[model samples]
Target: MSSSTLGYLARRAAQKERVRILYRRALKNTLDWAVHRHLFYCDADELRAKFDANKHVEDLDTIDRLINEAEASYEKWQHPDPYIVPWAPAGSKFTRNPAPPQGVEIVYNYGKEESD
Candidate 1:
């Protein structure tokens, strides 16, 4: 194939990957806003429908435009206070009790060291 054709194929592949990432992020963001399983399912279905509707587009320019619009929409509607797992990074309980530094030992039995 010609260099132009190769470049086009590469661009298309990148665009497809971006779309996949965007969809996943949007779905996860949706979960942050959904309080119940049924509600999450409904929202997920609607989000899937939106992506499916654009699945058949073959024009690169159109695909790029659609992706941009979808990203913008996602940004505008993202949850203000998203739900985060307590153990995950940036969560409330993350790194609450970090491991001690090297050369430091913690005695579990209270006063036993002094008594000994």
Candidate 2:
């Protein structure tokens, strides 16, 4: 095979790997939203269908464009922080049921005392 053919194959293989990674990340994120095995199956199927729907594109440019658009959509929609804001009301674990400790004393200030 010609060098150009080998280069094209290499680029295609890299793009395929990228798509697989994106799909897996999307499925894991779906689990975060689904919260149940059954729900996740349904979500995964829907995601699979979205990719399957575009399986017939012969043009490399279209495939690359679709992959990029899918990736952008994934990045735009997915939530980064699963946990609640640390300082927001009802957010922290301690805030859920805050109470005084059984026994404790302030041994030292968090910061050094000022000379003044």
Candidate 3:
């Protein structure tokens, strides 16, 4: 009901969002290193366990500190060359074949006789 309570709620929501984003990024980064789906699933479980270990912490400062540490670790261990979809930006097939130039007309002939 009070302004302090509202501020606390907002901070908590923001922290939760940051944690969610961090978890997703970490999982996606893990995929870059695990070449096989089976291995990725195992790694994913381990990563989940690590996050679950800290899920019970109620201190906001502690949560913030953990988040910062996780982010730093993520940056340090990120893959140098992550896999990208062929059609995605920076991929080999990205924009490889662009559309034809504007005002260019393409005619399709179906059994039409040519007149000289």
Candidate 4:
């Protein structure tokens, strides 16, 4: 291949990589938002117990609704949130620092902190 062709191919490859990374980051953010919202609005223990007792239909429906609401909220807030990375022109000088998944504090504090 000619030098110009090779350079073009390389640039295209780099652009594709950047696009893939952006897409993956967006998907991760969306999933994290949904999971956090679900946990926030639902009683996990009670839901689990109901599931174990074969009474999960209503709980499942409620969980679905909560997830939908959470997704809507995420979409609304994502544009303005610093934690969410916005799509920029290729080679732009922007750094992405996605927020960590929610509910992490509860897991980290499991039995470690005494309740008042």
* Clash totals, every prediction: 0, 0, 0, 0
What tens-digit string does per-residue lDDT give for candidate 1 at 1-116? Answer: 99999999999999999999999999999999999999999999999999999999999999999999999999999999998899999999999999999999988886666645
| Residue-wise C-alpha lDDT for candidate 2, range 4-116, written one tens digit per residue | 99988998888889889999888777776786899989999999999889888867888899999999998886966653456786567547656658795555667888688
TM-score, structure 2 vs. true: 0.66
lDDT of 2 at 25: 83
Candidate 4 lDDT: 0.49
> 14-116, model 4: which lDDT tens digit per residue?
6446444544444455444454766634544443343345333334345445445544644664534333334553323454554567865425675687779
Task: Using TM-score, give the best candidate's number.
Answer: 3
Candidate 3 lDDT over residue span 1-116, tens digit each: 99999988999999999999999999999999999999999999999999999999998899999999999999998999998989999998999988779998767777787898
Sorted by lDDT, highest first, which candidate order results? Answer: 1, 3, 2, 4
Could you list the CA RMSD of all candidates, in the order they appear? 2.6, 9.2, 2.1, 21.3
Per-residue error for 59 in candidate 1, Å, reads 0.7
lDDT of 2: 0.83
Between candidates 1 and 4, which one is better according to TM-score?
Answer: 1
Per-model TM-score versus the true fold: 0.87, 0.66, 0.88, 0.32
Using lDDT as the measure, name the better of candidate 1 and candidate 2. Answer: 1
Instruction: Report every candidate's CA lDDT.
Output: 0.95, 0.83, 0.94, 0.49
TM-score of 3: 0.88
